[model samples]
Target: MERLQKILAGAGVASRRKCEELIQSGRVQVNGETVTELGTKADPAADVITVDGKTVGAQKKMYIVFNKPKGVITSASDPQGRKIVTDYLKGINERLYPVGRLDYDTEGLLLLTNDGEFAHLLTHPKHHVAKTYLATVKGVPHGTALDKLKNGIMLEDGMTAPAEVEYYDIDPEEKHATISITIYEGRNRQVRRMFEAIQHPVTKLKRISFGDLYLGNLKRGLYRHLTKEEVEGLIKLARTAGKPGNRPTPKKDK
Candidate 1:
């Protein structure tokens, strides 16, 4: 048995939080009776659940790794008709939510899944699932600025957690540089903001990896389902974060 919200989210009805709202609003019924309590649980297989009188059936969980191209919205839908990440997921029927968001102008490894539990586990702040990005900045960051990024930067929200930062390439003539940074926190436009704070705004950015999962060779706008082993490995990585020896220095992407 699982929580009713979990069942609804796993069935692709909506996110877990939205499903909980649906339950609280008296839209969900279990075994032909309305279930408005937040603590309600039911066996998904045996219980006939409905939302707005429509039956909710279990859906096969899907885990996909998408190489998100720039200029696409990270959301499942866009009102202004802008292309969204889901639009690139051609022929896949499952309603998969992005595990976390990448900026509309940012590109690279993006995880999508119908499994709410897995998505939550990976995205929770305490999990510290490291995400690595390669950013092309307007100016080459000097050692002092890089060190400040490696330590922490005070943002409007608060002092950001320490990040792993290293410069990969420097073009003196263009005054541009490419840097690889790994961060544990999932703040909005964090990488871009970090550089902006250092007075070297990012010109381009691409996420190269999330935890142990790498974007590797996957062309932009293409996607592939995660192998069982890969999915399991991500779960283990998130679950074991903060334990002794679990925090290793992030490797720079070649």
Candidate 2:
């Protein structure tokens, strides 16, 4: 299910914000019941939605979980015509776009959806929906350095919000450390930048999870439709994030 304004907006009835105004003014109805609340959710395909006595056309909301391969730009299109994420979604009929983005050379879990509200909620910093990444770095940062990273780091942009940063594995012989990082903000190259500020550069990076979505056994360059339960799990998280005084906390490992 999706927001009523999104349904009406997708049907070419009006802009999404205008649809909300229509809902507040009692000009919209769902299955014969007037819905004036802005947060009310409904499935456009299952419900008979109307705006100002006009029927809103049916549109299916689509979601995809993709193991984005390296060297693909996470965007709808690239000006230089380089390979893009949509190239991997060739057969998809819906105009699904990436929820946030992964850098061109970064790989791992990425979400694609046609729902604007869902995308906005997930990516917005105020919502504080955390995204996770696994990074291989050169040196093992210990003691106060780890504490500095966990509390907050001073990047060129400014001080970042506190992150759940830890070393899941460290190979002293190989001089390589595998770090698991959970961050609430989506700053540009924030993960790599965080490590850099601590004097441990990120060698390779992959997003392992976004909100409740995980990569699991999905291999690289692969894509799949999110299961019903997975979708509902995200919706529930969004509801919680919407509450006043909701703050981003370090999520416990599952």
Each candidate's root-mean-square deviation in Å?
2.1, 6.7
Error of 2 at 143 (Å): 3.0
lDDT by residue (tens digit), candidate 1, 1-254: 99999889888787777889999999999989999999799999899999999999978899999999999999988999999999999999888899999998999999999887788889899999989898999978899999898889998888988888887778978689999888998999999999999999999999988988988888889999999999999999999873222333444545
- Compared with the true structure, all predictions reach lDDT values of 0.89, 0.80
Any idea how many clashes model 2 has?
A: 0
| lDDT (Cα, 0-100) at 101 in candidate 1 | 96
What tens-digit string does per-residue lDDT give for candidate 2 at 1-254? Answer: 98888777566454456568899999999999999999899987689988778887755777899999889999888999998888888788777778888998789999988765666667767777768888888888875887787788898889988877776778968588978888888899899888888888988888888887778888888899998898888877766664322233323334
Candidate 1, which ten residues in sequence have the lowest lDDT sum?
A: 242-251
Q: Per-prediction count of colliding residue pairs?
A: 0, 0
